[model samples]
Target: MYALEKPQNFHRGTSFSLITRNGDDRSETSDYTSEDEGTEDYRRGGYHAVRIGDTFKHGRYVVQSKLGWGHFSTVWLAWDTQKSIYVALKVQKSAQHYTEAAMDEITILKQIAEGDPEDKKCVVKLLDHFKHSGPNGQHVCMVFEYLGDNLLTLIKYSDYRGIPLHMVKEICFHILVGLDYLHRQLSIIHTDLKPENILLLSMIDPSKDPRRTGAPLILPSSKSKIVSESEVSKDAKASCSDLTKNQKKKIRKKAKRAARKCIGKEEADQDIEVSSPEASHRDDKSNGEPSEEKSRNSVGENSNNDEANDASEGSRGHKRGSRSARQKLLAEVELKCKLVDFGNACWTYKQFTSDIQTRQYRCPEVILGSKYSTSADMWSLACICFELATGDVLFDPHSGDNYDRDEVALGGRYSRDFFNRFGDLRHIRRLRFWPLNKVLKEKYEFREQDATEMADFLVQILDFVPEKRMTAAQCLNHPWISVGPRQLAPSMSENGGSDKKQETDEREAMEVRVGNMAIDGAKNGKDSKSMASPLKQ
Candidate 1:
């Protein structure tokens, strides 16, 4: 799940809600679960029932609010009393399997934190961890540095029109940096890499950020009652009550339209089901002014007509100004982000499951039941880059024949299982070959130069042969990623050559390490092509 907190003003309108979901952490009953983590899971071996004022690890971390929840764990926004700062507290379920997963995640997080002492690896940092014994059972709680919204929220803020090319390049650079660190230095593979797992460093809106807004931390109180999920939902609704009816209606319409564009038809249908009548009623009650109240205030309507007209004009100006301000904020947003949610991550030689990665980001080799390595993550990164550029998934497979729409007939250890000797899919007869460049130009209206550059960078990583896919370090040096202003590595002139020399030396060292791995794989009867070979360059 994502390790970040949603702003208090955020509402669940789009299907791409900021709620994080690890690759295989979702439970079977997730389809029918409520908006919140349901009460059904608050049993002896289930989720620890967390309250607003609850304190964990002997009052070191104080729960402020629920950040999000997944089948494996629940994340909370909490105050770190020891450090006097906000943090994300992830409380895992006490079930045996969940406990094992937590232990694995903790081990990976510790390695990451230890390796990146300067915190420049673009991965989330593990702050503190402890076991909390609750009524449910002893739960493994992990504390992480509190981050801002995920890339999904950033996409929504852009109205699903997609961000600028420069911004996309900036975000891609950061993601590749993180992936390079994981794949090269730590030998870890983030099995799941998607927009939801990448988070910005700060909130999009300054007013909503606790640090920026000088918001007071919620102190622990013995008299405070446990806040139920229903009460939390009500509180979220109340926060948006001041929005005008027309404004709320506009938001809903935009959200539904964007949801349809973002998610597949089946997922969209599920979202429609989950948006029940009771939820609509709550929205209506919260957003609409009551008729009785309007009638009672009608006595002064005539007298205040002139004042109302002036107020209306002022409101229009304020709305225009607000729109401009929001645009400015988006333009000035820091593009730096970090890779988060390592629950499904595994080392190159110690994979926990064959079924890794979410459906949209799953690679061809995995689908074909072949061997996978760090290259699988490169495929997912390519998909995410496409999504960030186009505001839609690179591959959105549906049921039946549609599921093989993006499948390519490539030679692999298990290729014969799904493909014929003549290089054709056994089950799917027909195929439409639309190259990445064509898809961008014809479908998304990308300019020729932009389409070609993007296709060049992504196609290498999206190669059917896993061993031939570009390494993260190679991708970092790609021309497409270097188009924008360099943020991760400054120029020699900007830093008096010392930092640049160090950066270059590090990149060279990583390439050498990757080359050594490739040689080792080749010696073990793998492909002759080195993973560090820059296919396009």
Candidate 2:
């Protein structure tokens, strides 16, 4: 059905192979006739010993090497032999997660693709899906655009220095764009946004062509039409230098350009013609200089400026053009963050209410037993933002009284930290277990002051009551993010740094239905989904 070869025309190690498939018809008789001959030939050719080479003859894709592995799926780097392109084949294993997981994955993929395809850059593109019967029974597979490494590795290489402020701005913009699409357009909350899940469009390799790699790769232009792998390696090396005066100057210039572009729709439309006319005049004047004389002068000036600005902003309108691009990337990250381990995902609002996020990132409302909205995503975003900036989790309670999982699960770090910080646990209610005194009695030096201060700082975000947790829209305007501590990264000393709106609508609707189901089902004397155990559950 498919063939694999190390094409002579292409480089070794990794290269494309051709595959051909007929229209849903196979010569069955030929299969029988060729079986014996094929087996003998396969043995003679040593085909059985081929390592890291396997083929899956789907409609048109022939999946090849295993590219990655998740808990429930294995992704293969595949070839759309008919189209002559590479793709990723995510094969769903027959694990417990897959029996029911495929539906959710497919639904999210299709939803993201069909809903505003133009804004779907952040989300992986699903090209096809197929089913095959194997020794274990039937299996499912999905094909997506092949992406290289993820942001996590990039962050790792940064040594937790966090991405540069300009880069962070770009990253934030992309994430927000993706999130805005998901929340408003798709009515969904990513509910999760971390480094690992955010992937780069190009593969992370020093040997990859610059034009074919990274979120900030240079576009094809007159200066260099084709960017080879060596050029990318050079760029990466240059990017490693500490921020110099020249680099800062270049960054400021780029920032100015970016600020102009983001100066609101009214300002943009007003200046569109004005700026273009002035720029056009400047280009025309510059074109008439004596070629040799101009070239000699240009070398000194261009090298000095380009070397510094290359890391901060390119000659490309990356500073200006990247605003929308960044938003799209952020939106993509937010979307994938939503498609995480559903086993741990709360499918409804009520479930989300009862089961809050990890203590470090939990919104104050959740801590105080107040209501929450899709805006709860803001709290998680803050947590991740801090991590990206500082390379350390904001809150990981591993100290004080060591409580087991059961104790932590039943009573919650909220209850424990609540009393520790507030000097009383009486304000908390509706927990499955734990008396007020017992909760307070867990002798530990809870960082109540720290928690309270942190919460107070985020108060505009997560109010003491659930109804008050900041919405994603409100968060966009929050002082901390827009102009406060989060904003410190750009203006403050190298020490500080800062950092979605989505999944609110669908989550609100989902929450309401789930809540109603719980209420109505309770009245009818029916059991809800079994209350999972604190420890085992």
Candidate 3:
């Protein structure tokens, strides 16, 4: 079929009527069995493709193609013809149809973006907002800069081969920058931080590329460049088949160019006889340094690094750098991490009133029924930071059921695994919300030998007591977070030995207290309901 070619004089700024010569009226939604749809719908189902050339203008942004949709609004890949760039359009299905939670989210997003300078940059930029009438009613549309895949996609495609340490750090640091902006600057709380929400500006490499390492970048061909307003108007009037073919060709060319570019200048110019062997050896050595760290990070696999790039496109550049340079780069990264997502960040004092993040990344404070603030964000930062360094999540539960309600209502795996490891904590000190002894017996059958290992990591962070959990600042000082002296744990004090010991002791005590409280409540009639844990949707 021949594509409809429109007149070149069509201006983007002017309003134009879109006449449908042929309309295929079809609507079939797959409503799953589960009623809860916070963010899991995308995972459980497929996203609907927008009708090609069906134009919807929101202020300066003209809706192009539907990218994805969630509970509150539908996300569209759009063009800001005036700015000459591609942007994400989040249009509300209908203003009147919005739930109270959805309305609150919209207001919170606006406040965070427009509230503080630091917060503004951390969030996905809000370019414009407008009202449009859908078949149902009036809708609210928001425009944002379009980003590529999220962290989850990057990790899934990583070939089960871990991501480079530096790249992991880069992603974590960037997220922190955004988190800090939200918690510290704007006093907002994200309540949600997971692989899905973390979007990549560009694809480090195509999903099919052979080279899987090196600096992250987009295939030049895949790189979105602004099309002229006239061209966009003409194209918007074209048919679906025509647009799909153009997009495919555009992707293929970009992939080829990306492959050519993957041939590093150093590797490309080296002597053919020995260079390949030498280069391979160097890569191995770099990979060697982070092995232990990677294992520790992988224990849970909460992080999904496949969201940002495809493993098919491997690394090609320098692997490890000098300690000094690495430290400097790490510091610079920590400083810049304030750029990722600030629209819904919260401070230590802020209470995260809404369910915003993915299940795993949600902090224990958020999980247990505690008020959210910077501390909660710090927890998320630590999780992401760990993922960056090791390519894994810290406490991702294996079972699919919502652990929050299960833990409270039925006292989950702690019945078997926890007590079996820690032995009966009957003789241990009073924990915050639980009965120390009863909980030990009823939950994880605590063994004497299990206490040490159990007390070491997970229990400390997932303390069930929000106040007792470590803050991101505290995590920055932990050995797991640091590599060595002003070298590894640069965020910590090397010389303040006694002070560090005291702080550690205090944290330990807090953990014990919180544990006791939870167990005690379980034993008694008192409510141990925490504000940290979330209600399953």
Candidate 4:
């Protein structure tokens, strides 16, 4: 993914194939400290085998740099000659079997775009889509507006410690907003919701388009549009990515000298810079917690030690004082995020698999072989929330899984706790089940009220029966979320004010109920539908 060969198009012993490396900006280039020792073992037709600076679709877009890769495709940060800006190009794996999911994704994205153009409500925007033929085979390609690194990367940049609660709340809130839009407005099921797919929105200033200034940059296939000098440097680094290590160092040195000359400075006094916008791919070997790779080539690690130390202090202080110092930074930065990778997404009207969700996030309904709806997505969100909060999975059943599966480590005995609630699945005696609040208190060290509130919210969504679980809309409206932390929601406030007059009428007219059927039956021999916690009116 990082190379800088001199020839416009030449093969390298280390690089995968012949690349058309053209541009020559290296101010942001880092010296090569790591080697591709095992890259030769990759198959010739593999996704990572593509050369840098490769043009596709009649050279409408020029490959700039490899953004990252996935099991089914490799993504590159490419320059759009047509749009005069950088964009993300995803090339699907050569295998045609993966085509079905890609096509489905395209359809879902288009439908979502058509439904709500303004719904920057928190879903990634698909700018364009097309296909390309390569020696391997015909590969489907997608174009997306270049966005900042994914949440997994950001978490690593912040170190393995849990993020401040305010930032975490905002992130989770944005996720729920996106989920609400998909589940309510589009009726689309994400199927997958993990940190990897949660990406921060664009970092580029949208108000400025670089290509208006005329510049004589010649190319046969590419139709060069005039762009600002700042962006020019960025695109140049992408094209010259195939240069050798010494070549990169020399080029960078010369560029810095030229920059210093322009400003009449004797020397470039800054540390070697990494101009690439993308952060390093997350270190996946840490069981489940995210960690940054400390390899010399990794971006962002060397840029700032003060910020890391500050974050550490801020996190500790926030824990003690109950307010995050970085909350304003998150808001000011407009740190919006969106869900990507609709490859596994399916329409509510169309069903793909009876089994859905990654194993750890799987809801009880699917585990019990019962039919599931969008509520399955809700379950996954609950699991993701727990993971984000505690840096651990909530309900992993396997020892080999990346998330912690042992409940005893979480301070609870799983068998004793769950058997009472789910044991009836085997058609045995139905013991009284433990409440979610009790479980949270036992399994975690959170404050009592905090545990109670979280458990209350989770309990509504984690119902043993699928039909009883809170829907996405219900989740959005839950007091724990909508009420703004510890404050009471206006509608649920004690005063029977005019604002809540209608709500009070409806609620008072509504009959009050309590207890699950099993508990009620055990006490009074009455079979009844359970009433979860009352809405705090």
lDDT of 1: 0.61
What value does the lDDT take at residue 439 in candidate 2?
16
**What TM-score would each prediction reach against the true structure?**
0.66, 0.46, 0.46, 0.55
Which portions of model 3 show Cα errors greater than 4 Å?
Answer: 1-50, 95-103, 115-121, 206-357, 388-392, 398-405, 408-464, 468-470, 473-537
Runs in model 4 deviating more than 4 A are 1-48, 157-160, 202-334, 400-444, 483-537
Greater-lDDT candidate between 2 and 4: 4
Error of 4 at 33 (Å): 22
**TM-score comparison, 1 vs 4, better candidate:** 1
At residue 537, candidate 1 shows an lDDT of 21
Note the Cα lDDT for every prediction shown: 0.61, 0.38, 0.38, 0.48
RMSD of each: 19.4, 26.2, 21.3, 19.6
Tens digits of per-residue lDDT for model 3 on 285-338? 222110001111111111122221111011112222453343333333222222
Question: Which candidate comes out best when scored by TM-score?
Answer: 1
Sequence-dependent TM-score of model 1: 0.66
Error of 4 at 383 (Å): 1.2
- Residue pairs in collision within model 1: none
lDDT of 2 by residue, 281-393 (tens): 23222222111110101001111111111010111111212434433433333112212222223333324324445444554445445455556666566555545544444
